[model samples]
Target: MHDLIAAPFRNEHLVLRPGSQRAVKIGAAKFTDLENAVKAGRALPGWLVDVARRAWGVDTFDRPAHAAVLVRRPGPYEFSRATWELNLGCDFDCEHCYLAEKRFEGLDWAGKARLLHVMRDAGVVWLQITGGEPLIDPQFPAAYQLAHELGMQVELLSNGSQLGKPRMLELLAALPPTKMSLSVYGASPETYDGLTRRRGAFKRFTRGLDAAVAAGLNIDLSLIITNRNAHEADAMRAWADRLGVARREYANISPTIHGGAETLPSQSPEHLTQRAPFTGCPAGHTFFHADPFGRASICKVGREPNIDLPTEGVAGLARLGSIADSLMLRTGGCTGCQLSDTCRVCRPMAKVFQEAKAPLKNYCQHG
Candidate 1:
């Protein structure tokens, strides 16, 4: 368990502490020297020792560089980030969930370990662990620990439903995430429970949220505004302010990943904001998303023609750049449309809306 990681991030060299956002930039020469020191099991560099102490209050002066710091070797790939869906199962059945089905099936421990290693080899330095609710996964603790051990800064995306458990809190305290993003459905139990279609959902959420705050975990609230709970948006922001945590609001609802329109009705029309016009993205070029089964796609929205990472390994990622290019092309109904010049949704997202048979006004500017 090293206290910090020194790695090459693309063209830059960065020294980073796991679970902390503090980053120290060093020249290429210094990065190479630190790497050599770790290889030779040398004592911690005086400068780094001072840096750790001053930045994080960590004392590494007496520790060997090899024992106290992990020096990450750069890989052939340029990817520095990724998001993995551990499982799709959730305790709550939110009406606006994008997944049409919430199955608990996914890779076993062995498969998961292999996929994570593949991600690490692909140069993923920052990994987001997500799911219908990641904390509820039985294998979460070991998997999270393994990600950190592999020198990847881990972020957790959860509903904060299971965060109140003693074991969960203890695990977070020992190895904090880069950030824990919790979804806030509502401020009160009635609206929250109603939105999630679960009894006592709000109670459990607040309990876990408060526990996380008290434990000093870096947390951010995702204020999910829906037709059912849009009235509580201000209250949700106020709650985040009271907790002294950061928050972002998400009011627009999308169709399910399976192209079902069931979730569209939950969108709060008044709160829907205009999306910027479609621009270029670096989804597969710089980062990718992996499903529970280790299927790597350009992103969460563009799911077809994915690579099976566990079976094909990291080598298969070579095809992603081309796949991303093809997915972004204006095709299908978007081809030659006069509004294409000002279209807000990307081709993949537009395809989803078209499949769901949603009204054009919901996704197209022309409507």
Candidate 2:
């Protein structure tokens, strides 16, 4: 708090893009201009000073903290946003879970911090911490705090069950994230409990949302639609509105990470009719996922690691193109379908090629 506002200011160019134009350079003379502005009573955060220094001809390897910055990015799929599976264990037994039940394999606290440092070295600007339930992960809180301290905007994709606990609330108050996308299964206790099958889960969910909002943390509700609760989509959104939180509704269902079909979504024909233009997947191009253990993949459901994270750092990103190329083969239903022209499907790379699993029969209305 030593007059960070009045400190000497330096304007620096932050490298926001990754490609032929690798480093973004900002001149120290420009920094002198900003410092002149600061001397004239303009205020800015201490972190901006670090950013300016990193951009003013200082090599990135020297300053790990000033990794991400504001600039026109390279593409949506660059390693700009990273997703981490902090743990594969969850307290509640949800019906439509994407993660197959697996033994708990988590990185120790030091390992978690090191992973973030490596991602920062590769210039990841945004990070998402998710899991079977990231809140239950032993190293999650510390790892999350480290990401924010490293100058990355962090978000948590949580089920919101434990958000109201004394320890959980304390952690949020200490290290609030950019936002939390709290998954709300249904609008009612009966619907929520029926989906989650955990006693008092509905009460806990609401309590967690309320606690997060009270602590001044940005909170958003994500209502996942399954056949059992499809009729109540409006009610769930209404619940979010009542709580004064932003929300998004998810209606698509995907096979489990292991290609298991038992827990698949019971989507209706009308839901399958919804369509969007087929742009090439952002996966492998710019986005990548990592876990605490040895896994790294292009997408969340696409968990057959094309490249290992713990053993390989940013180098793994270079191989993503090969993985994406191998996935575009003429597979079962996609061989002659006209709808493939407009279908926004990318998981076949995981299911058909990597897992050797058959094409997900109910994935779309192409049949």
Candidate 3:
């Protein structure tokens, strides 16, 4: 069943169509073999065959594999449940902005619509609108509404500057988000503003948070742990506690990268050693990132164009499957490392190594 369900990735020419009822087809083949495989029953991967039979009511191999396919399809396509970076630009000039160098022009209405349509068609059931700050984009409300209309659970990540404004709060109230993530660099204005490099930002962010909470929006306080603010974790937890939010609401303590480059800081080794093992770095598997410039990356940190989906519509998501297949075949430091539990590897990392013609030691540590 594993082989059958994960079969398309093995053949470069195979393609799976996404929708309420999924279909699989091999390139240049007049008929799809999915039905044949389903008929083979016991000969097929047991888990896949069982899943197909139980889920889709397809008990025979000669029948369609729709019963075996999951919520969407049996391919590499997946969507973010709780995170996304909508654009690179932010309203605040945070000193630690990872994409500080990248411009932040918001996507136009048309582009936003296209993205929404593509996301809905690709089965992205949950999405988070992030950015330099998503609130800065005027089209944000429309994007949010569209995602909600398509039955996608939506979340917003913001520096919280705009939320304090009555109009912005009203807009947010009108849209009714599933959750809102506020990045609190510091508990106090002096410290927060110093980190953001934007005076008075801390006040605005807190005000926005207060307004959001009052409006009954589900809120998660995001913290960026770095050399300057790792000690603030307890303070942040206290703030969440005071606000009646759960402590587990805090997200991963993302290590600040030096200007989003592939190179790690001098303390990276120690940082990696101290960090807990993360089993879920589902880049090519469950999530992907597409920049404003139309380049599709497997993860937020992996910013490389493994595939270009422009004008390809839903069919373009197949590239993720292809990329995952490619990565599984990769040999070198990553091939058999037990440290894969702690190591992070993605197309962006691979691209950096491919371009530099050197191994990526800093990004992927072998056990």
**Which candidate gets the maximum lDDT versus the true structure?**
1
TM-score, cand. 2 = 0.76
Q: Summarize candidate 1's per-residue lDDT along 175-240 as a digit string, tens digits.
A: 999999999999999999999999999999999999999999999999999999988999999999
Best by TM-score: 1
Q: How much lDDT does candidate 3 score? A: 0.57
Q: Write the per-residue lDDT of candidate 3 for residues 275-364, one digit (tens) a residue.
A: 344444567666766666445566665554455545666677677756755654446544665656455544345444444343344344
Model 1 residue runs over 4 Å out of place are: none
| Model 2 C-alpha lDDT per residue in residues 246-284, reported as the tens digit of each score | 888776665567666656545533444343555677665
Per model, state how many residue pairs clash.
Answer: 0, 7, 11
Worst 10 residues of 2 by lDDT: 1-10
Candidates sorted on lDDT, descending:
1, 2, 3
User: Which model, 1 or 2, shows the larger TM-score?
Assistant: 1
lDDT on C-alpha atoms for all candidate structures: 0.92, 0.64, 0.57
Model 3: runs farther than 4 Å from truth?
A: 1-84, 247-273, 278-281, 327-367
| All-Cα superposition RMSD per candidate | 1.2, 7.9, 11.1
The superposed Cα distance between candidate 3 and the true structure at residue 357, in angstroms, equals: 14
